[model samples]
Target: MDLGKSQRVTRSEIDHILTNRRWSLFDVSVLPSFDTGSDHRLIRASISLNKKNFERDTHRPAPHKIPTFKSADLEPAIESNTWTLFEDLTEDYDHLVGAPLKCADASRHSQPTTIPTLNDRAFAFLEKRKAVKLDPNAKHLEKVITG
Candidate 1:
């Protein structure tokens, strides 16, 4: 064992003996000529032990509660007596539904012309029906008119 170039050190047989049964030495090395300000040379060893002997915390925190609302809670406002039906409200029907005849007067230089095509009238009627069907307030208006 070359302990160092300047100083030599030795270990006894009793120093090499293992005291504990759980601990086992894996490696042993001698560090020489490293200036640590001490005359004695440094020796290092790797050891292994069983980790299953230790205890650990496995508990988890509880989940938080959140508030939610149902459609039934909103039904009172929809069915209220004060709710105004959209059809009962005053609105210019001819102006709201686009009349091609009305556009003839809008131009000063052009002569007033009427839409003679039955196909154009049918298309306008279909468009108005689709608009009424898609309107959310139209349901309440229909209920007031029919009943």
Candidate 2:
């Protein structure tokens, strides 16, 4: 069919569009041309359902649950005044979130690497990185560090 004509497109069509393919949608005119010579037609399709389903299928994270450790779970050891157990458990949690850089010999590495720690500051830094791009001239870094 002609490029100007409209048709009911599917998720596959939208995908094609996203992948840089041309999409032909039906014209919005109340009356469609009966002449076959014309290259366009008045087509109707529901984007709401397609958009909603696409978002529902692709928007969220993969189905997975992270393990959790509660401080109260260590109450027995704490009651026994076993600080060692507490420290060990704390270290385990740290390792679970991120690998130990010292163990990785970070100083000996040629490339600079950032170890994300489970803390408010680390989270805020990540948020800033996502929201802003780093400038090569260091203008953005200067504003951030000084502010």
Candidate 3:
């Protein structure tokens, strides 16, 4: 069949059969071409059915029973009171939403701030390290080995 007049065209077709034995195929044919802006042709089929007695419980299985768990088996790692204390420490929802300035305010900056140089970053890192007091006389190797 002449599916289309395009220079580069491809044909696509599908065939299927009904699983039910009662359904019978009577006739099959390729339908007339229509201006659907597509190259694939359509197909039409005629099918007939013969009524048969269908037993409800012939091949069907019984419904499965879902397993139930006891309330004692669902103990969480953290207690409810501890969860409430953690929740209280968190910032308010409204503060979190309103914390950041709008995009328009951020884009309207008159002067751009200069980023810190590598030397400046290194100086800051060294200052922070010097501020942290370490016990020089403590047995660091022995503590790590024991742990």
> Per-residue lDDT tens digits of candidate 3, residues 1-147?
334567556665444444464435667666555643445555557766444434532456645544343334223211221222224435544433433222223333244244455687788766655444244554666445433
Off by over 4 Å in 1: 1-18, 51-147
Give the range where candidate 3 is weakest over 10 consecutive residues by summed lDDT.
77-86
Question: Which digits, one per residue and each the tens of the lDDT, describe model 2 over residues 4-106?
Answer: 3465433221112122212323332322546433534434443233555556666765445433334453444335432232358778676544432333332
Candidate 1 vs candidate 3: the TM-score winner is: 3
The all-Cα superposition gives candidate 3 an RMSD in Å to the true structure of 27.7
> In candidate 1, which residue pairs get closer than 3 Å at backbone N, Cα or C atoms, i.e. clash?
none
Report the number of the highest-TM-score candidate. 3
If scored against the real structure, what TM-score would every candidate get?
A: 0.20, 0.19, 0.21
Tell me model 2's lDDT, rounded to 2 decimals.
0.43
The lDDT per prediction is: 0.48, 0.43, 0.46
Tens digits of per-residue lDDT for model 1, 1-147: 334446566533222335344345667765563543345565567766545532222334444433233445334433442333356335445433433233322322432254345787787876777777777788877645533
- Clashes per candidate (backbone, < 3 Å): 0, 2, 0
